[model samples]
Target: MPAFGRTMLTHWHLDPQVAYLNHGTVGATPTRVLAVQQAFRDDMERAPARFLLRELTGTFPAPWRSESRLREAARSVAGFVGARAEDLVFVTNVTTGINAVLQSSQLGSGDEMLITDLAYGAVTMAVHAVAQRTGARVRTVSIPFPPSSSGAVVSAIRDALTDRTRLAVIDHVTAMTALVLPVAEIAEVCHARGVPVLVDGAHAPGSVDLDITDLDVDWYAANLHKWALTPRSCGFLWARPDRQADLHHPVVSWGRDKGFLAEFEQHATHDPTCALSAPAAVALLREWGWPQVRDYIHNLAWEAGRRLTARWDTRLSTPEEMIGAMVTVPLPEAAGSTDADAAALRLALLEEDRVEVQLHASAGRLWVRVSAQIYNDITDIDRLANAVRQRLVVSSVESR
Candidate 1:
């Protein structure tokens, strides 16, 4: 581990006994950020009525909904993502935000929703439901396993579109491949064709320096819990000012008519701890130099890819330029990268080596996905590589 990595690990509460490399699946909240969430939970529990009725609403005596603190937190998060506070609304996670947009949309026969083979499964399911209900079709562009360049990506999407293409749902950073898509270019193409774009950026917020406004996408949804150091269930949905009028909450509640922010803010009776602690999460990362953290993790991911590719005699799914804080490499054919094989390998790595990582069966092959966070260093990847080598060697022997 690098000296700087050692210093960063102290701030996180990850179990040292386990070599945790699956940060992309679900992020590990820093100790300080967790403490902030705990404080909010405690306040809510202290006086449920006072906190919910008076404090949360700031009503009755003052006639104001006491969401100023949460709004401020949203403002802080907006600043981090290069969005205006009014344009962003805090949601539980990216899935919910995408669902909200899809549900509000009007799809019908011959309508098309553009997506790729690399999108997250849950989001794909949501798109499916929307399509099924309205007789719309999901137009999928099969991005190459190892994309040649961002230009190829843009061209693929542009050529795939037709007059029926109503909306394009693009992944800013694909979950399976970990390839960072050229969103700004795609958005420009979609707009020129009179098609709106919804960017599923679940893994992009903290992994990359984002400017949602600059991307010019009609809608963008991201999960802060993935890489932004926010507690579980924290995410944000942003719609361009004009697009907001077309948006609606997934679950309509008492606040339906109270404008965009209010519609999503008071969805139902739920814990606000995650949303309330959002500002602290962003602030803590900022104080630690979020940009530096992003660069460090990115470098770690790239270095891990380099080492693993060299050791396993495999190639990366995409080039280093297309990757962010996570990278995926194809496992050797003899290693068995199927659904069952990937599951077995993941379990073996955890049980035999105490190494935590992610594996997915994609493109008819098994690929190992590793994530780099501040708590991780070269040593962690080194351990992971060793475990992988041992498992593959043992598997090869048994098969022979």
Candidate 2:
């Protein structure tokens, strides 16, 4: 977007004063895409029977055509990560997608599901619930701070792996720490030892340039609602086509006939507006083009990281190449990013700095994760950094 052209930003109606650095927290949809979605919703609402029953019919090809359009936006999503399109299925969000895969999979009493200590809390609960049902054990690769390399991540996960380990679930980017794991190497290690890898790429989709087909993980789930910058209910689970039979939907609906992908798309419909909006969201991204957008967002985030790194006590958790758009900066010991506190820093920044960010604790470290999108700029980062510096300085003296 051009600096002078009010047209770009005027396209959307976000609060002008709030510098939103938290695109990672359910993306802010562009006005154009959302407008299209609302139009679809309005059309559906106006003549519910016409759009839902008559137009959609029972045959999925028509609605599936919309998904295919979204898919064409990039098979690189799976391709880059090292998976095929046949292996992938859509869901409303990663939680739903991951839960579907976990609950329906054949994990049992003697089976174990491996995960990282750094995983998103909600996902951890989902994993535990499935374990509760199947009597599977939940083991984690404890990735403490000072984790130095891709090798370190791989080694930690490898050590956690045992003969009973049915699946190893790792994060492409840790939601709390913004840390990226060496999933490809770990995938290779797991595959060699007869374990399947499930990647939680909740933050990867539109935030980073992803190619799932290139990654060796047997199962990958991503939330288009988060980084993908699509609507709230868009997410996907892609499995190796061969493993497709091994997996089933968390919700058992009309999918026994064709395959898992069909199963996901045909999820029961009271009215399919939210899910149907996904194609329009994909269309918006295609219209904007990420080449310049990625570079722009990266530069802003990198500048923010540089600012955070300049502080004496603060630490940077994410590796350079690993974190393209999101950067995690460890806050001082006193801060907390969880909701009860309103994440003082996050709220203060939003209210005062007009800069929105996410503050959370992971690995015993408090952090503020910064995210950037087409709507963000360097000035926004500057605003956030300034507010953080000002507050921490006061906090420093209060501690004394």
Best by lDDT: 1
Tens-place lDDT per residue, model 1, 1-400, is: 2344745767788878888999999798988999989998898898787666556534323345545656777888999999999999999999999999999998899999999988899999999999999999999999887799988999999999999999999999988778889999999998899999999999998899899999999999999998998899999999999888768899988668677877787668888789888888888878878878889989999999989888889876576779899998887777785899889989998998998999978767889899998888899998988888888788779989
Error of 2 at 242 (Å): 1.2
TM-score each candidate: 0.95, 0.86
Candidate 2 TM-score, true structure as reference: 0.86
What lDDT does each candidate get?
0.87, 0.70
Candidate 2 — worst ten consecutive residues by lDDT sum?
67-76
Error of 1 at 244 (Å): 1.1
lDDT of 2: 0.70
Instruction: State how far residue 382 of model 2 sits from its true place (Å).
Output: 1.8
- Of the candidates shown, which would achieve the greatest TM-score relative to the real structure? 1
lDDT, model 1: 0.87
RMSD of 2: 3.7
